[model samples]
Target: MKTPKITIDRIKKYLAEGKRFDGRKPEEFRDLEIEFGVSKKAEGSARVKLGNTEVIVGIKMGVSEPYPDSPNKGNLMVTAELLPLSSPRIEAGPPRFPAIELGRVIDRGLRESHFIDFEKLCIEPGKKVWTLFVDIYTINDDGNLLDAGGIGAVAALMNAKIPKYDEENSRVLHDEHSEENVPLTKERPISITGYKVGDKILFDPTREEEDAGETKVTVGISHGIISSMQKGNETDLDTEMFGEMIDMAEKVWQDLVTKIEKFIK
Candidate 1:
């Protein structure tokens, strides 16, 4: 459901003062909490909460033929479902644009950053390769599901174990896990999203602030470098706004990554 104009006006007034109802700075994110292995069946799973926004990500492995171009490398498939229970706006049906966008964004970030070592996942050159399925589900819609999802995706992959492969049968033994973890690189990508409403910009906004947004800029950063950027909504932004967000994203990554490091194993 759309936020009422009255609430939007209140958000704008608070934003003008560089304050949020939660008392966070314009560029500050809400408290983040992560839980690993939320699903026993999945090879890897995580639940991440950025304030009231929450997303659950799970990783599953399957054996599949390698793509013609990347015969020696495995594949990555990212999917997201924004459940009807998560918000009043969502409906029970096939994924809509928002859910589709969320998957693509996270997939691009992971692929661009080379977060996973796909070559290592190959079972046989030009034949069988491991395909990692990253599934995301929204449990709440307090806003900023994009960022929370990014965190959940990374956490789930890190928490995943390589399911054993039976070479003779060319099958993935889901019940048996290998001792090795998923082949992840040293770099990790995190999504930093900025919302512009009226004359103010906020990161990790509440649902009301998000509904009042004129535009949104989301960037995926790893090791102080931006891997991908996406713009949402109809409002056009000038070069100055883009520049400001880049700077903001870089700085935010430094802080955000630090907070996430403590949870890594």
Candidate 2:
């Protein structure tokens, strides 16, 4: 939807005054809620709500041939489906650019952070290995689906279980009686996106604010280190503004990680 010029102007005016249309501080994030094991069929699942935006992620495990390059390690795949019912902007059809981008961004954060111990997932070196599939669905699209989706994906992975593999039969046992928690690294990585609007930067922007913004930067943080970064939109941020954005992202990363840990535990 095309945002009205007046609305964009008003948002900019509010930001200049160190305020937001939603009455939040520039660095503030909206209320967040997380629920785990939302899907019984899924080996692991989580539902995350940030303000009005909501996303659900499910993790499924299976045995498959190891990749040629990573013969000793398992595989991970992330997919996102933007339901038309979630937003007017999305349409019913195959995965579009936005959905693909969302999945890639989340995948990068998880993979770069090395959150999962892929080597341990190897059922048999260079032969059969455990493959994890993370599926994400948009339930609502008020704004900032990337961060919400990323959170859902990570939370779901943390909740996931490793299905028992019957080596004798060369088959995966999907029954509830034969399952164990998946192994993961001690560090947890989280993604935080900052939106820039006419020299003003904010975290976790709403749909209207995001539509009115010029550019956004997504940073992945793990163990107090940046694992990955991605910038979106055509607008260019000044050097100083870019540094400030990174600092802001780092400041908020700890709180987000703490919140997710609390929920998943």
Candidate 3:
């Protein structure tokens, strides 16, 4: 793919002029669109679009024996895949470094926030537990997949319904007449990632700006508190910048949380 020289130059010029290429003011966010239940077959799923970037997240849950060390808690697993077919630059194969990095980042966000509430997932104390597996797929690598994927995954998990377990039978009770459904509790985490380019910090960067970014940072905020942080690809930020970004992220996170909460209901 030919990198748009004009696009790069335009953004660069904007930076030089103390402006942004997209004409939005500094600290502005792109138009966002989110939907739950995008996948009909999955127990729960969500799709998030930020500008041209798009990501889809799905959650599948099952019953399993609790680990010896954490007999009373459940398990939460997260995986991320960047489909080569989604972007020309990506190649088909085992997940490359980017895919792995994306997975780890999201995992930190959820785990650090105590979002899963594993203790509550315990079905039979040391015998059984609810395992939540969150899967994220990049259908389009426009930009900001981390934020989109993170939000999508959390939203999907919030809406997921667990099937009843029959510990005596050592199986899940999926029979329509006998199966029971469970919903996640109210204490869940939400995240929003902001990108800093030049002197401006933006809510969600488009593909072009992302490619030109000097540094990228992902922040996870849960219930109005900062939970986790991950910085990747580039780094030139100073202490002041970091503090400012955190403040901006706190505000942005609240707005996103409000919207995502609606999907749960």
lDDT by residue (1-265, candidate 2, tens digit) is: 7678999999999999998978999888888899998997888999999999999999999899999999999899999999998999888999988899888888888888989899999988899988999999999999899999999988998888877778899877776534578878986778889999998899898888988889999998887888888999999889899999999988888778877778866
TM-score of each: 0.98, 0.96, 0.88
Pitting candidate 1 against candidate 3, the one with the higher lDDT is: 1
lDDT for model 1, on a 0 to 1 scale? 0.90
As for candidate 1, its clashing pairs are: none
lDDT of 3: 0.75
Global lDDT of each model? 0.90, 0.88, 0.75
**Higher-scoring candidate on TM-score, 2 or 3:** 2
lDDT of 3 at 11: 76
Model 3, residue 55: C-alpha shift (Å): 1.7
Ten-residue segment with the worst summed lDDT in candidate 1?
A: 256-265
Q: In model 3, how large is the Cα lDDT of residue 140?
A: 82
lDDT score, residue 10, model 2?
93
Clashes of each: 0, 0, 0
Q: Total backbone clashes of model 1?
A: 0
Residue 167 local lDDT, model 3: 70
